[model samples]
Target chain A: MNIELRLFARYREATGVDHERICSAAETISELREVLLARGDHWLVLADERLCCARNQTLCSLDSALCDGDEVALFPPMTGG
Target chain B: MATYITNEAIAAGQRLDALAPSHAAGAVVSFTGYVRDHNLGEAVSTLYLEHYPGMTERALAALEIDAYARWPLLAVDIIHRVGELTLGDVIVFVAVASAHRQAAFEAASYLMDQLKTHIPLWKRECHTASTTPVWLIPH
Candidate 1:
């Protein structure tokens, strides 16, 4: 499955890209993270466990499901006011 | 109460007055945030604000709805400006209208706190693009 990934905050800065497309062979977030990591190990290290996942702009649990073409946002814990 | 969140333009004084009407609203409490020239050790020239459009509205509306459920709030307005802003430029303003001062004060505080912690706005602190820090806001 292919998914749209949105990045924000330091993650956006680090990757120097706000959004990207990734192809995933597995169906879960754990699988998606692995695919994302393969592209940028630094993103993997920085992303670690602090990022929140959003599916279709709605906040999702770690165990939340995903589907092809979903708009997923990966972000650091929000630091804005 | 009504809510206002914009990335375009806003009039702070007018927004405050409008939220607090003549008769029903006995008190109005307003909270305003400005782009500061300095942060910690850095001399900031201007700040740029960015946000996730759909998510921002969803979070703000959920907050306002919850505030309405909790207080006897008559009206409330939350206006936030986006793009580039300079020192003393108002970035966010929250006004609450209620029959008494208590709810007005509390709701006003609540709006800012919620916006800070929950909204999906991001800010970039620029001493110049070369020396800037971009951050995401919670509310």
Candidate 2:
């Protein structure tokens, strides 16, 4: 399935890209993280347990399911007021 | 009724005036979050805010609705600024109107608390005087 990955804040800074298209067979966010982690060290930030994940704009756990065409956002803990 | 995410500067006074009592509203409470000069011993030259476009509005609207559900509020306004900002710049504005001061104050506080930890917004701080900019994850 092809999914849209959205990166924000530091993640975007480290990767130098805000969005990307990834083809993955993973079913859950955790598995998706593994697919991303296989890329390289720059992707290691997603390994941080403190990292937050959102599936389709709503906060979701790593175990949350992913579907084709889903929009997944990854970012650090929110610090906005 | 205006819950917004903009790159423009916010006028707190004007917003408050707009929410001023027209009938039975006896209290108005507001909170403005400003970009501070320093954080964790670093002198921040600028701050950048980012948000999930479609999701940000939905999350903020949900928060506002939640606040109204918890209190007898007559009105609520939330304005969050994105893009680049400098020290002391207004980052966000939250205002609540109620028939009593207690409800207005509590609702405003609740909105801010929820916004900080729950909203989709993220903050990045730059200290150009020294090292590279860093993203700050609030605990």
Best by TM-score: 2
- TM-score on 0 to 1 scale for chain A of candidate 2: 0.94
State how far residue B85 of model 1 sits from its true place (Å).
1.3
TM-scores for every candidate against the unseen true structure:
0.85, 0.95
lDDT of 1 by residue, B1-139 (tens): 4555576666788887677665888888898788887876677888887777677677778888888898998887877777778888898888888999998888888778777656677787876535546453332
Error of 2 at A54 (Å): 0.9
**Model 1 C-alpha lDDT per residue in residues A1-81, reported as the tens digit of each score:** 888878776677777878888776658776677667777655764455766767887777656678988887777665445
lDDT string, candidate 2, A1-81, tens digits: 999999988788777869999899999988988988898989888778889999999999989999999999998888889
Query: Which ten-residue region of model 2 chain B has the weakest summed lDDT?
Result: B130-139
- What lDDT score goes with residue B99 in model 2? 91
Q: What total of clashing residue pairs does each candidate reach? A: 14, 0
